[model samples]
Target: MANHRAAWTDERAEQVIGELLRVGVILSVVVILIGAVFYFLHHPAARANYRTFHSEPDDLRSIARIAAGAVKLRPREFIQFGLLLLLFTPVARVAFSVFAFAAERDRTYVIVTLIVLGILISSIVGHI
Candidate 1:
């Protein structure tokens, strides 16, 4: 256990976090694309009505509802969930930074990274 912990160096942590970001983005894209395909499949010949402005459905007004819609494979909600995932990718990196710093016994960095993580979360949650 100690040997494995020692092997988890800064470079390794960075590489893992980088991969997290890349995979997150790729997964978001795949989700969005899948939703788009589903949307088109259901509305192959549908055309946009430009006569009046339309708002998003009431069911997509909250994260819980969006998640529920996504679980049910609703197209717009699924795409919105994908976009929400993309938005949180960087936030996840910052959160991992706190863990990495804690593992290294770097209190200063852990504190700073925690502040950054808090701000990121608040900024996202405040408007919601």
Candidate 2:
């Protein structure tokens, strides 16, 4: 009887692990698709620029020089940068929720994620 119980428990554990793996794969694919859409919509040029900027030490120096040339309008650019940073808050929240749900199957995480997104949207509308 004890042996039979142990075998049943092991089988249940395996089944749970398998289900988690399947969920994880599906969640990963969804996250990737969302990221692709966001990237294409908001900052299609950002990846190319980032690659060039980090390509070498000479590239870094060149980027620095270009930034230095923009010193006169730095204040305006800084404000724009802050707004751009704020725009990412909702995307980050969604990504975090996806991972949390996939790893732990927690419903509270979904609620928290929605709250974060609401706050981000409110802040953006209020501030800008």
Candidate 3:
């Protein structure tokens, strides 16, 4: 009975994790699409200035700027925010996995997950 219960718990955890990932990806795509729509609506005549390949403008560089721009319904910021969400999805997944492993009293897995989470977060902020 204990074995069966553990198996059931594991299966449920996997399902929940899978759902989390699917939802995250779908939400990211939706937000990005909405941003694209806003961009096209506001910049109907703007051409792709990809030849220069310059960095995004100051307003699109930082999260603070992006959030402020998003409040003003700026499409580039919306797209940038969406991209941020996309970037954080896997980090969120690892975060969830850490909690899930802790809940299961799986100390080894929990530690490993925490290490992975730490590395991921470090990578994100390492440059800063």
Q: Judged by lDDT relative to the true structure, which candidate is superior, 1 or 3?
A: 1
The local lDDT score (0 to 100) that residue 2 gets in candidate 1 is 59
Q: When superposed on Cα atoms, how far off is each prediction in RMSD?
A: 2.4, 15.5, 3.3
RMSD of 2: 15.5
Span of ten consecutive residues with least summed lDDT in model 2: 57-66
Off by more than 4 A, model 3: 1-8, 126-128
Candidate 3 lDDT, 17-91, residue by residue in tens: 899889889998998999999999999999866877778678887767887888888999998888878888889
Local distance difference test scores for all models = 0.87, 0.48, 0.84
Predicted candidate 1 versus true structure: per-residue lDDT over 1-128, tens digit per residue = 75765666689889989999999999999999999999999889999888886877777767788888999999889989898889889988898888888877789998999999988888768446
Q: Using TM-score as the measure, which candidate wins?
A: 3
- Better candidate by TM-score, 1 or 2: 1
Per-prediction TM-score: 0.85, 0.32, 0.85
Task: Please give, for residues 1-128, the per-residue lDDT of candidate 2 as tens digits.
Answer: 65643343434544655665556555555544554565466555654455444443332223343234224334323333333334454355465554555345456866776777677666646333
Candidate 1's C-alpha runs over 4 A off are: 48-55, 126-128
What TM-score does model 2 achieve against the real structure?
0.32
